[model samples]
Target chain A: MHIIEVTQLQKHFGDFKAVKGIDFFVEQDEVFGFLGPNGAGKTTTINMLTGLARPTAGTIQIAGHDGIREIKKVQRIIGIVPDESNLYDDMSGYENLVFCASLYGIKKQEREKRARQLLKQFTLDDTGSRPFKAYSKGMKRKLTIAAGIIHNPTILFLDEPTTGIDVESARQIRTMIRSLNNQGTTIFLTTHYIEDAERLCDRIGFIVEGRIIKVEETQSLLQEAQREHIVEFKVEHLDEGVIQEFLQSFNQIQVPRISDQTIRISSGRPIELMPYMEFLTSHNSKVLEAKLVHPSLEEVFVHITGVEIDRLKKEKEGKK
Target chain B: MNYRLMAYGNILKKDMQNYYLKPPNLSWGIIFPISWTLMFFLRSGSDVDIKAILPGVMALSILFGTTSMLSVTITFERKSRSFERLLLSPISLNLLMLAKTTGAIIFGIINAFIPVLFASFFVDLGGIQWTLLFSGVVLIAVTSTFLGLFIAVSVNEVFEAQTFSNFFRFPMVFLCGLFIPLEQLPRVLRPLSYLFPLTYGADILKFSVNHQASINRIVSFAILLLYAVGLFLVSTHNIKKRWIY
Candidate 1:
């Protein structure tokens, strides 16, 4: 079942269109990743879907209810972990969770019980009593996620849940996200981290400049670049001129230099090692190592969008 | 059990724990009013009517304690983005505002009571009308709190909210018959005093203290109620319009 369906979603801030007619849907019990660089309207889209912001134009349906008109009903069925860990700073970790539960009209006893369980599950049992302001970035992120799920919403919207935190905390969050998905809660996550989307997302949507460039199942997206093969050869001495001259003899290979002593050659057909090995030997450079590399999701993103991930991030931050 | 009431109770409880119970807030709400009252009493001299001035002191306490605290709390929550959590919940915005206003009113009434208790030591309370005083306190508390919420929702930052609240509050202190009586003020300024809710509050408090039915208590109460309801609606509308991204 499609738990979230958005069509022609648009948001404008004065003359600048933040999100321009974006359309997508999140399936039941699936970890759907909304991937974008910083200023790509990822957060804006999330805000609209969660009813924190009104769209300039569009229809958003979440958990079988209209996101705008039936906002209260939609709010009841979806939990949102915003990009910022914005729980009350003066309240304890446990208090924040219990307080969030209370907003959903959970009984006091049930809320307390659930708060305790969530603290334990999020590895925050020991620190639950401490004020949220005193928590480390990682602990704050964990508590924010825990608080979002305190009501057991049918769908969870995680907006960069693991950004700017320690590696261990990010790992723990990823694990928790998987566990939640396994338990039948639909996850709609927006992230700038390429590896996070590559690993956790069942389907990935590439949103650039407020438009979803593409939305494809993770495997199928990677499969598009699968036909190409990368061959890495480490030699005793590397010369770009010599390697280019040798590669000129073979029209099928495209050599991209990795380092002085290393070069990667990509080809549409499988690269034969013997011809490249012989060519290198004739130049008095011994092949130290050789390996085949598969294209990563990051590479797929670059291939599809023609924008490097790092450059995309820098541009987004600059716009911000 | 009503879920709206439950949500309101929880929101109030959380706000109390997070903002109201802090030492700075407590000191500002409780100690500041007492000190201000003491300063006013010392400066006004012993010959000045203490009974007449006590009601103004109580009104001032309600104004400062409720307005400043509510403004600070609302702006702090908005700046920290914690207010977004409340906005995203299934709870009604009206209930949330009511809960917040109720919390501020409770604090305002408590703060207003301290000076009244202190004044009781110097002046006899036997002749004072208890029912009128109680009604005045409740009405003024609601009016001041809603006014604070109005200022809070009008601005986006904590500093701006505080600045805007002071801009509204300081004028009321001087012109709203708190420090100067309407009859004593210039003819032009007397009309301006009526524009302030604090003027009606002071008038109500004055009638309660003097045990003289000069001003109609019903009119004063009705005007104060209208101010409360009007401010409440305006604040709610502003929050719905400006608070969302």
Candidate 2:
């Protein structure tokens, strides 16, 4: 059964529409990623699903409860970790988690036990006694996620789970997310990192300009990206003469660029790597390495969404 | 325990820690009332009877203490975005707001007694109506906390909350018969005085402490209750309109 079903969901602020009637669904125990650029209504849609924002139009059926009319019932079964940490800063991390669990009607002893287990799970056990404000960004993010799941919610909504944190922490959080989903929790993840969706998500939805452009299985999208063939050759002491002659020899091949002893060749059809290696060898240019490159989810995302990879990379770096 | 009560207790506990348990806030709650008492004596120069001004001072103490704590805490939480966590919990908006305001209501009630604590040392409190006194203090706390909630929802910044609280608080001090009697005020301003919730609260305190009141006891209690409910409804509406979406 689908864990979440949203239809024609729209949110408007004044005259501007933040989410322009988007529809999507998350299946049980699957990681459904809503990937988009900044201000692409990813967070807005998540807010509507989680019962934080009221929709201007359409319906949300979450776990069989009307999200708009019966948000309180839906709230009990779901958890939310906002883009920013919403846990109390003045309280200890442990205190914050226990308090959040208590809001779900967990008894005192059970909440304490769960808080301890989660603190250890998130590698925050040692610093659990410290105030939330004193923790580092990564620790704070981890604690916030821990708090979100303190009651072992059926579905967890994470907004930018890995943004603005250290690399090691981000990796650990991704691992934790995977572990949670493996344990039968449905996850709705919205992220700026296409790589995150590539690695963690089961199905991907591409949203642009407040509208969903595409929603497809990860493997299917990657397979479609494979239609374009690319080959890269790492050569030693590569010069302009080699590239000019190499292009002249292979007219169907397009040499995208030559930089740092590497030449990237692209074509609609597969190119024979041996011919290129022998051609370079005959020209007295030593070919160090040559390999066919598989297209990444990022390539598919760029192809479908039409947003330049450079712009997305800058947004990711700026977030970091 | 029931889940609703559990949510209420947890929210109330957290807010009490953030709003009242801190040393600075605790000290401010206690010291502000005492300071106001001292200032009253210092300004009136020794001949002014403590009993004559006790109702006014007690009403002022509850007004300042509750509004200051509740408004600042609400605005600060909203600014830091921590309030969203409470808003998203599996509790009704009314329950959540009640839990949030209970801490400041308790703080205001405690503040109302600080002046009485000082007054007990100098005067005979044998004839004071203890039932009326307790009822008056509670109603004042409830009304003042709701007023704080109103101010908190109406503004975005901590400073703005403080400033907005004063916009109602300062005017009520003069017009509510806290320091001056309602009869002594200009005829044109007396109608305005009745509009403030504090005016009825001050009257309740006066009847309780001095055994003298201009308005009927039932009318004062009813009006104060109405104001409390009215302010609470308006603030929650504002929160739903502005913060939820």
Candidate 3:
């Protein structure tokens, strides 16, 4: 079932159109990731869905309730972890969770119990009543996540969930997200952590310039990005003409390269790889070593987007 | 929990927490009000009774506590970025402003009156009316607190709140006869004093304890109450605009 349905939503900041009539739906208990370059209106769209930013035109429904008309109900049903948002500075980490819980009209005794349990789950314990101002960035992020999920909403919307944390902290956060997803909570996360998305998200929507370029299951998207592969192999020697005869066994094979007594064979499959290696071995071709490489998500992203993500990130940072 | 009451009580607790957290500031705040009350008692001792200065000293402390320390508190919150977090909470903008303002009133009352009661034991007032004096203290504290809240909302920054707060703050004390007698004011400025809510607050205080009731004294108290309500409405409007958009 679609828990969040957004259609023809448009938001224009003065003359600049931040979101231009985009459409998408997040389904039940599925981990969905939104991938995009920095200026791609990912935040603008997410803010609209979270009711922080009102759309100029369109309809967004959260569990069959109008997001604009019934914003309070929409807010109640979705827990949002906004990028770079602040926790209450004067309160302790435990107090921060209690404050958010009180906003939902939760009883204090229940809130205190839940807060203590969440603190243990995050492996966090404050020395005393240390204010949030004194907390490390990772601790603050963890506290915010605990606060967001305290009410146990049907859907969780996380934006750039691991932006500035250390690698160890990021991994811990990823593990926590996986646990949340396992418990039947629909996770709709937008992130620059492509590796996490590729590893954890069941489906991903590549958003760019206020549009969803492609939305597919992660494995299918990777397969679609790389239909054909060029395999490179090295051997001690090769007979060039006979290799052509051996290549005819497959649907497609490139002529082998023999340079400095090393033979390199190009093919789509490693199974096809064994056959070529066999032929070269029987022909008195001295086989030294072979390794198979699958195309990575970074490479796949570059192929589909036609631009390097690292360079794009640099340019966006420079502009900022 | 009654969420509204919880919010109000929590806000009050935070201020008390803030107050007790820094012992030096608390000590200084207590001393500042006490010293002012004593200085006024000594300076105007011969010319007028201690009762006249009784009102002066109380109004003096209320003025300084509400205008100076309260402004600094808001500015401190702004500088620390704590104010933004308050804005994001589900509490309405009006309650947030009310919480802070009401907190100031509580502090102002303690800073203004405790010294007066303590000093009253030192000097005896013959046939003085204690009932009217207490009522006057209530009115003056209310007006002073609302004035501070108005300044916090009107100023663009916390620093600006301090600068502009003094523009109205210092004059209200003098016009209300905290130092120079209201009768000694140039005839022209006396009428101007009538325009100030503090003038009525000061006189109602003087008449209630000293048995010097005038028809004009009653009118000033009514006007002072109106000032309190007006400032509240304006501050609430400003906070509402901040949240809605």
Q: Report the number of the highest-DockQ candidate.
A: 2
In model 2, pairs of residues that clash are: none
Ranking by TM-score: 2, 1, 3
- i-RMSD values for every candidate model: 1.1, 0.9, 3.7
Q: What is candidate 3's lDDT per residue for A1-320, written digit by digit as tens?
A: 99888899998878988788888888889999888877888888887777666788999988899987776676666777877646667678888777667655567798888888888888776522578778887877888788888878788888888877877778889999999999998999987767878887998887777777777788887776465454555667666665656566543664334344444444454445677677778777767876654665654554445445445456435532
Each model's backbone clash number: 0, 0, 1
RMSD of each: 4.9, 5.2, 9.3
Per-candidate Cα lDDT values, in order, are: 0.86, 0.90, 0.71
By lDDT, the better pick of 2 and 3 is 2
lDDT per residue (tens digit) for residues A1-320 in model 2:
98899899999999999999988888999999998888888888888887778999999999999989999999999999999998888899999999999899999999999999999999999999999999999999999999999989999999999999999999999999999999999999988888899899999999988899999999898888788788888888677887788888887776655565777677788787888889888988899988887878876776667666567778888877
Winning candidate number (TM-score): 2
For every model in order, the fraction of real contacts preserved is 0.73, 0.79, 0.11
Each candidate structure's TM-score, on Cα atoms with residue i matched to residue i, is: 0.88, 0.90, 0.73
True contacts kept of 3: 0.11
Q: Which ten residues in a row have the lowest lDDT in candidate 1 chain A?
A: A311-320
The full ranking of all candidates by lDDT, starting with the best, is: 2, 1, 3
Q: How close is candidate 3 to the true structure, as a TM-score?
A: 0.73
